[model samples]
Target: MLHLDASSSSNSKAISDTCNIDLNSIIKIETQLQDNPYDMISLVFLLYDVPDTALQRLIVYQRVMSDVSETNINLLQEWYCHASSRPNWQHELLEALMICQLNSIVKSLGFHIPTMRVFYLSSDPFGSKYINPVKKILYHACENIDSTNLKKLKKSLLSYDINVMEHTTCEIIFLELMSKKFITINISQENKTDEGIMYNVENIVNILDKLNGLKKIVNSLRYLQSKPNHDTIKLKQDNTNYGVDDFNDLFDLINQIMPNTLENDD
Candidate 1:
């Protein structure tokens, strides 16, 4: 009888330990997202509980941009956590974004850490609305094969890490996007920033020049096309250093830069 009691007690302790670990993990996620996620990336992936009347109007104003999926949102948050911690986390983001159909919406979810706010704003505030025809090349590249395609894309994406810093490299893609010319943005900066967070003409010109340098590989047709110099951008995510929450920062930035861009809830 004593042995049976001991066994049950041991089992209960084990279960309790497991539960505690899981709970801690969940709390960690909440803290990371809420408290100090901005140190990792300028753009944040998050949701808001605020009244949606204002957000809904923005959606209607924008011709009902595609919906952001819950699964992708979770995946992005997970990726953000990993990317903030581990350097190799980009593979997960690239793969997830590739498989996720809600790329358009996913692209817009940037968070500010200070206030725990979420905003939908374009990253490229001043680039032209131009596109490279071969972007489909990347899409098709992923479609034609099996594990090999995934492997190749992973390799290609990860290859950028060979020279550039981990998370900061993602900023380079924004420059690449501008070079492709698929972006046109109008940003209003009430005040100036040393970071040039606003999308003004000078910002556009500086980005274009820096972007061209990154893609200027010797004689290679594949990547010779202009790409943003991944090395130029610095990463901002650090738990130790405090800043605005990803969600709030994005909202404030968008609200400040493009006040009319998002429709008011009322």
Candidate 2:
């Protein structure tokens, strides 16, 4: 049974401390769904923050099927229509956690948002009933790439390490992972990492602002260009797993915290 005693309170605090997801980000996504149900949604999960969690959510397609589904929101459409849309927009692979989890919210609000590709960190601990329903509704979106851009993308991923927060900029590499259709990217935290080194939303936006291109996104001066990778990973000896299991844990935590959502105050 659920406890309400001091011990329970302590446990709750522990849970809150251990389980963290950007609740505001989740809420904002939900709110957008509430206001614009027909908009497409695309999401990316960074399986490096909270293992076994769906870290980031991006909506990439808007297909209003049934009346119940019509009330849902779509991210891809909104982004395209929005003044600041991300470049190389892939309208097929939207994230599933937020959209599926919010199905009730969508129906209550009287809308629907179709999902596309929502990938997982590595398959373990990342399994969810959500994945099945989402897969039933949408087709898979990634495979071995054949495009020349993929080489560049892989080179970029190598720069990212995907298992070590090597550079001062993590969010950048995380976003880069999302751009390459990766739902999660793992990073090593064995060493005492630098919060100062981890690029925050504002720093990334400033970088984009400095960029000569993508004038629209930069113009918004929005602190966040995209969602931050939120998965938490656990590493073992030899690190042969590198970060898959860790990323999977990230998903689990994401599943727990995403329901509450966080605000972008920082």
Candidate 3:
């Protein structure tokens, strides 16, 4: 019988984690695709990490277009011909092509605007990294908008019977959204005849809530993509932070979530 200590167990887990997709294999497949643009086999292997349904749709679109028009076929041929030799191929042309295809599919399927927005955000490789802060702010603002504290502040203003400008509400929302640590809203009242009352409201929004919102959005997009029927899809409303998720984790998650998408043809 073998006995394992805590340290040894941890080491074993680390070793198991190393079995993810090989970076060298990705590079080799990319090179092979560039060398032979007409190789559908290599193309499929290169797109091994994408969702199965998305890959199937692309294949079906390609087959349909091939039979539809000579001009369209020539255009695709030219596109791949250019892609094969293009420098910085993955980041530059590959992303653009994926976005174009996603856009066309969204339009053809008549996906609602909200669904379109979610897909568009997911398609952006830099979205999670760049938009995290903004998402967090918006999430927190939504959570705090009608809080009892905020309502009390509003009641205090109404008791003073001061006329608040429409711009004042906009300013309050803006301050709430832009706040990092705490938001302070101040207004000054001169007299009973004064049109505006003066007061300051301070509020704190949870950073964790914002991070959780971002995770929910990313996960929702993944769920939407995996479903066969877009008409029945519904975004989850939970605000649980899924972990300290990042772009690298997102890529790995996608690969893990759709493992059957990458089965090598026999």
> Which residue pairs collide in model 3, if any?
187-198, 187-199, 188-198, 189-198
Which residue segments of model 2 deviate by more than 4 Å? 1-33, 36-177, 181-232, 235-266
Q: 20, model 2: CA deviation in Å?
A: 14
Model 3 lDDT on a 0 to 1 scale: 0.30
lDDT of 2 by residue, 1-266 (tens): 11111132233335334322233334555565554432322232311123222113222112233356554443333333431121111111122433334444332321222211123322332222222211211112111122442333345445445432332223333344434434322334564332211222343233334434334443332321243222221111123432333324334444444334423101
| Cand. 1 TM to true fold | 0.23
Provide TM-scores for the models: 0.23, 0.21, 0.21
**lDDT, candidate 3, at 22:** 30
Candidate 1, residues 213-260: lDDT per residue as tens digits?
322211121331343212111122112222123213333344454444
Give the Cα error of residue 2 in candidate 3, in Å. 46
Assess the local accuracy of residue 174 in candidate 2 as a C-alpha lDDT between 0 and 100: 37
Q: By TM-score, who's the top model here?
A: 1
| lDDT score, candidate 3, position 83 | 37
Per-residue CA lDDT of model 3 for 1-266, tens digit only, reads 00111122233334233322233434433443343333432223222222233234344444554453433222234334443342222222222323323333222222222322332346533242122222222233334344444444344444445222221232233332223213321112232222222211122222222333344433433332232221100111113222123222433433343334323211
Alpha carbon deviation, residue 264, candidate 2 (Å) = 18
